[model samples]
Target: MSIQTKTVKAKTVAIVGGGCAGWSLAARVDQLSANTVTLYLKEETNPSHNWGFWQMPWLSDALSKKRAMWNSWQIITDEGIVTHHSRNHAYCSITSDDWFDWCQKRFHSAATTTEIIRLPVTNTDKNMLMTSNHKKRYDLIYDSRPPKADKNILLQHFKGLEIKTSIPVFNSKAAVLMDFRVSQENGIHFMYVLGYDQYTALVESTFFSTSPHREEVYDEAIRDYLSRIYNVTSFEIVKSEKGIIPMGDVRPKDQNPFLYSIGSNAGAIRPSSGYAFSFIQKQITQFLDRQTKPTNPHKKHDLMMDLIFLEVLKSHPEKAQRLFFKLARALNGDSFARFLSGEANIKDYFLVINSMPKWLFINQAVRVIIEKWKRIAKWA
Candidate 1:
């Protein structure tokens, strides 16, 4: 005779926010354990925008839906252009709408006990989440909301226009990672171009500054860059996208055991580069593998390096062009991509450190250390 054992019920999970992190976690959590997921979308749908990242094995499905890709990319400065090519990882772009849809399909196909609710989480008490309709308790809750912005924090802001030119102008094979030929009056300004085809491209005017410029400023810069660099006088704008990313730590203050902050709120956005897509994916993957709340995906050493780089950028905005140019020249395509994607090895880290201005970085590192010590003292 065999004795019958009791079956355990699935844990309930409520995920807040409809963006990349929320959807990503929701899609993959079933792999960790048997769980019922309730996804709370702030809006009925996600806003459409392009997310760019380097290709990786884990992201093969995403690569299938890429809008465009480049095996070779370049960084341009007044000094010259430095081009790098990586056969291992191609730079690819995917639209938010496509990504969200793919995530939804994956989640639904895998988990039958999932619900998608169109409501914003107003407040929380322990494991209980309050929505406009009702309050529900879950074993776990993941909040992917945008972090509150501070005026003093340096921000990476940009406005991109996807345009189609009548003439074959843009180079479709290579992407312009950073063109520092733009006006520097509005902080560390640059032009980023992603060419989809000879006649189509997404041109963005980007700035790393505390104070973002007006919409017209970005538009004017884009216009000037297109006319000057590409010699394009006329082009039809297909779509436009604008975003502002805080180049500062966004770790949550409250330590709720059942509640976790994922995505950018968990510091997925690199303080120096403002790259979040790949980091967010890394955070989710780790969370699934560990079966716990997501933590900052970036390595401590990488974060420290980013902090020092930010300090240098803040202190010497004028030197931004030269600094970035030097960095691009120092690393090949694979190393640069790995470094930016937070997968850098010791050699990659050494290359980055050696590329920077010695004295400036040392001074910044000291400043960062002192500031940390002061904060510790104040807290104590």
Candidate 2:
């Protein structure tokens, strides 16, 4: 007697871009079946930057490696300060260097064959990816390269400095999400502070605008902010980081089934808030659960709300502070965190809508609708 058996070959996966999304997906894929994965890194080492997100159950492992976590955070404006405290979802931050190290450790610990190559993907033809030194074909390709910025698109840009004071000064208990006491010459400017301890903190000068200012401009702002707000003029600069994130509708360039866009290129960023870490996590989670290609994980209604909010900011930049303050005041800490993390419930959504200025929102909503219609017509 004889029996016939069938065996299937493992899939070959190629992931482009070495940023958070690429590494995150590679780590997950390394744990799956016997898939052969190749992660292409544009650079040998990732630049250091802080990725901030709120704590959630699925992110408990990442949270364990957090550089800093705060149970309370505050938003400050000329009118007053609004403090929020969350017992369940603490705001946490992790640096890019640490995240890459963690992902690498996980990759090595996994029992699958995964190779990381430091090469920029120069071109792609069908299922083949061409690098400067090598060309390879794979069953699936996940591209996390940042989407090209559209002309005149809204942008969130910031430069941060990790400073150490000779004496204790910072309040380590809470984080300053937004301090609007700084100059508003730029569009929708604010200072964000994460006090790691009494002697150490990261102070960033951020702006939501169509164009970012020069690096020196942001540096001067940070200096002025520290001198005026903290009254500390002498501090040692430990490290610095700067980044520019597009805050508009960013879509994938192609619609190939085998080639999937996995990160901000697939619209993981919230247009209004410029937050993508949590959404990227959600996208990865859904992709793994369904055993399918990843798509944009944002809900339609939430995206629409973000569009309207962005329109409001574009039309009335002066109202930015008030809008943020009102929205923060309307929701509790948990609700606010959930809303920002894109896990808000109906009640949370309602609170956000109710907190906005009625006429302003209506006007912006109409504008967004008309703009979308015009785009469709132009395409047609």
Candidate 3:
């Protein structure tokens, strides 16, 4: 009897994008493979961003540090307010700074070949990354760069204002996800926070297709939201953040020979929810597990949520915003709770999509069909 094992030579990975995805992928690749991993970061300072995931069972262990836990959210509607609570799980929020620090520290000690190159990457075949200092080649490349900003593409633009009040007005326990009492116009929605801090609260206003002064709009919305929800007025602003999440519903081509897309660039962001941290982690782990054989690449999930998501953003951005708010307003407390817990199934997702005004969906579908038909007619 004999036992045999084969060793596979590792490939060099050049990650050209230094957000959560770049650092995370670099760390994981360094940990899992005997390969050399280099992170090409856009910012020397860790960017201030927020990453939240549903209360996944594995997240407790996956996250290096725990920042906040929230069990309930206040969903506001034109009709009224409904409180959704889940005893089973609490949504977790982890700061990008913490994750980046953890990744840097882990990669330093992981023994796997890892480097963080502070530079920008150029898009080319020979050296996909072109820095003024040098050009580098990688067997595998992970690009996490944000899509070039375009007003044409419908996007989820948000501004988060982190406020610290002199006296505590926010509950230290419950997390408020959405206070829809404000305006749900032109596909914009408002999400308010009350539970993340002892004396701090985050008020966020989001728009689906357009970019306005998010900070300005958020401050105005918060003034109203807090006054309505907590009946409290003046609060001091400690810090603020604004981010544009490309709801780019378009699927990117496998552009380069060794290039692979990761993070939101790879379409990990849930089109419906605009959340991707947990999904990206799952995607990376599954990808690494399947990479044992060079010829066997990972299969993309067929759900094609991106396709539907893009269409909604392109044709019916307004309706999409309304639908999200409508569903949030209409759902029963228990079902909404389940949805937030990520326990809801595909059917639930579809149900929420279908819950919107049928006429609106129909009109949007008809418009898309007519455009396609016209294009075909012109081609013939």
For model 3, the superposed segments whose C-alpha errors exceed 4 Å read 1-9, 44-47, 62-64, 126-128, 148-151, 184-187, 250-254, 292-322, 329-354, 362-380
lDDT of each: 0.85, 0.85, 0.62
Candidate 1 per-residue C-alpha lDDT over 173-269 given as tens digits, one digit per residue, 9 for 90 to 100: 9999899998999899999999999999999999999987889999999999989988988899999999999997665544554567889888899
**How many residue pairs clash in model 3?**
1
TM-score of each: 0.95, 0.95, 0.80
lDDT of 1 at 266: 89
Tens-place lDDT digits, model 3, residues 228-344: 866768877766777767654534343654556777667666655566677667666656665532221112322233434466656654454455567776565546644544455
- Residue 182 of candidate 1: its Cα lDDT? 88
Q: Residue 305 in candidate 3 has what lDDT?
A: 35
* Candidate 1 residue 13 C-alpha distance from true site, Å: 0.6
**TM-score between model 2 and native:** 0.95
- Please, what are the lDDT tens digits per residue for candidate 2 over residues 1-380? 11111221237778898788888877776544546888888864435889899998768657977999999999999888999999899999998888878888887677778898888998887778899988988867788988876788889999999999998889888999999998888889999999999999999999999998999999999999999999999999999988889987886665554467888978888888898887888888787776666778788988899989988898899999989999989999999999998889999999999999999999889988998999999999
